[model samples]
Structure formats: C-alpha cells, structure tokens
Target: MRKSLLLFGFALALLSCNKEQAAGGKEFKTAYVDTYKLLEESEEMKDFTNKAKVKEGELSRELQQKAKELQLDAASFESEARVKGMQWAQLKQQELQKRQRDLGIMQETFREEFDKEFGVKRDTIVSQMRKFIKDYGKKNGYDYIYGTGEAATVLYAREGYDITKKLIKELNEKYKAQASKEEPAKKEEKN
Candidate 1:
C-alpha cells in the first residue's frame, strides 16, 4: 500500500516536471539510487550488522549457561526427591518451577531488548542515509533523485541514470570519516 502511494506520487511529480519542461523548453536532470545496493554495500550498515551479530552471540552464550545450570539443578533435585519425603520434594519442585519461569521471562526480556535496540539503530542509519542523499542531490544540482529497489519509486531508468555505485562510495566515505572522528572519543573514554 505504501509503495503504491509512493509510486502514484512519483508519477504525479514526473507529469508535472514534464509539463513544465514542455512549457519552458527546459530539461530536468534526474537520477535514481538502488536502495538495496546502497544498504548492502555501505560500510556503516556492514558495521551495524557485525556488531548486532556479536551482541546476539553474547546473549546466546549467557542464556545457554543459565540453561545448563538449570539442567544440572533439575538433575540433582530428581535424585534428592527419590530419597526425601513427599513434602520436601513438593517444595523443591515449586522452587524449580519458579526458576524455570524466571528463566523464560529473562529470555523473553533479552529478545525484546535486542529487537528494540536493533530497530532503533536501523532507523537511525536509514534516517542518516536519507539526509545524506538529500544533501548530496542538492549539492550535485539534481532535479529529482528517486530510489529504485525494494519499495521502488522508479520502475525504469536509463542505464546512465542509476547512481547507486556513486552514492554508495560517497556514503561509505562519509561513514568512514564519522567513524574516524568518533574513534578518538571512544579511545579517550577507554583510557
């Protein structure tokens, strides 16, 4: 639905541009960027993906360790239940159930937190890219710069009108510069 709306709006804009050009005998410069390629090839996105993987691994290990401990405790409780009286066994069973519930809650909480963090980071990155593209278009004197892949706004563009590679290069360079600037601050904090 969103893509359809975007395409409709784009079509209207193109019609307007064409009408204006016909009246004024002026040509409009336009280009498109492939969003999928931009995101896939950008250095910032690559870094974001790597960091997310590391965090996921850390969480998985922590969860696995807790689960292992719970398993050991359950085994010990089973042995004790055979020897202990029924009342004592029931009490221990309740305690074990509580621990299991707590573990499940912990797992759910971790998953939610991870998803939230990932969403925020992804939104920020996309916002930054959009702003960068706008600035780039203005600086380069482009009349219209459309996005092509995923929710594609431009269905057909001339071969030379695809600026995906150029945008990716500029975006990566900007990301590299930003990372370099932050590196010093990170090192200072570590010190």
Candidate 2:
C-alpha cells in the first residue's frame, strides 16, 4: 500500500511539472543561412573544381581529336563512293550523315563522363555541407533558414539576422579538412 501511494504521488508530481513547463514553453526563433556562398568558400569545392578544370583541356582535346577522325573518315567515304558510281555521291552523303550522327553520340558520351566525374567528386562535400547547415540551425535555435543565391526568392531579410559569413567560414573550414583527408591533387603541382 505504501509503494502504490508513493508511485501515485510521483505520477502527480510529474504531471504538475509538465503543466508548469508548458507555461514556460520555449519559443523557437526564425533566422536564415546562405548555402551559395558556403559552397563557394568550401575547400573540398575548390579541390573538386580545380581537378575538373585541370582535366578540361585534356577532355576538350580528346573530343576535338574524335571529331577530326570522324571528319576524315567521312571525307574518305565521300571520295570512295564518288569513284564507284554517279549515284555514289548520294551514298557519300549518307556516309556524311552517319559521321555527323556518330560525332553527336561521341560528344554526348564525353559530356556525360565529365558530368559524372564532377558529381562523384562533389557529392560528399554537398552532403557534409547539408548536415553542417542543419546542425548549425538547430544549435542557433533558428526556426527558419534560407539562401541568398542568384535566384533567391526570399528577399528583404533583416541585415542583423544574416548568418551568411559565419556559415561560409565554417563550411570552408570543414570543406578544407575533408579535402585534406582525401589528399586531392594539388592544383599547382602536376606529376
């Protein structure tokens, strides 16, 4: 009987505490964070961009060579057909068309490869940045967060409430650490 009474008293006390807490419920405040600048300042981003840029020339040259080869094959086909028959020029035109089609496919493939490379390199950085932003928002007790990107629709935000610079610095530091962990090739030195 004593144990039952003690348990009942504890339950009542808990209920009273809950009621009192409700009376002083903490309200969340609204604030914003800029993702665009955060991404721009990140070290991981810098490495990914630098790597991609370094490969740009090679990729372009390869594409150009492929195009040149296709053109040569097309011209060879055109001449071969012309020597075969009067209707051979018509056949040569068909060959030219096929060359154009092949070039288009090759270029598309090259573009997709480039895009995949960029995506693979940057995916982790973007994921980390998202988590960092979420944690920052919660830690700062912000009820709202948004961007100031080029197409940012949420305009007219208060100047004092902007956490853009702080977020950017933190993101950059985190990105740099992440990139260093990956040991990405230095942009300046090429082996």
Question: What would the per-residue lDDT of candidate 2 be over residues 1-191, giving only the tens digit for each residue?
Answer: 98677656654653454345323584435444456777888888988888888887788898799788877877687567767876877867776788788778888887899888888768878778766766776676554455445433322233455789999999999999989966756744554
Where does candidate 1 stray beyond 4 Å? 1-22, 154-191
Question: Model 1 misses residue 13 by how many Å?
Answer: 13
Strongest candidate by TM-score: 1
lDDT of 1 at 145: 74
TM-score of 1: 0.65
**lDDT tens readout by residue for model 1, 59-137:** 9999999999999999999889989978989999898899899999999999999999998999999889988887877
Against the reference, the lDDT scores of all candidates come to: 0.83, 0.68
RMSD for each of the candidates: 14.2, 18.5
Q: Candidate 2, overall lDDT?
A: 0.68
RMSD of 1: 14.2
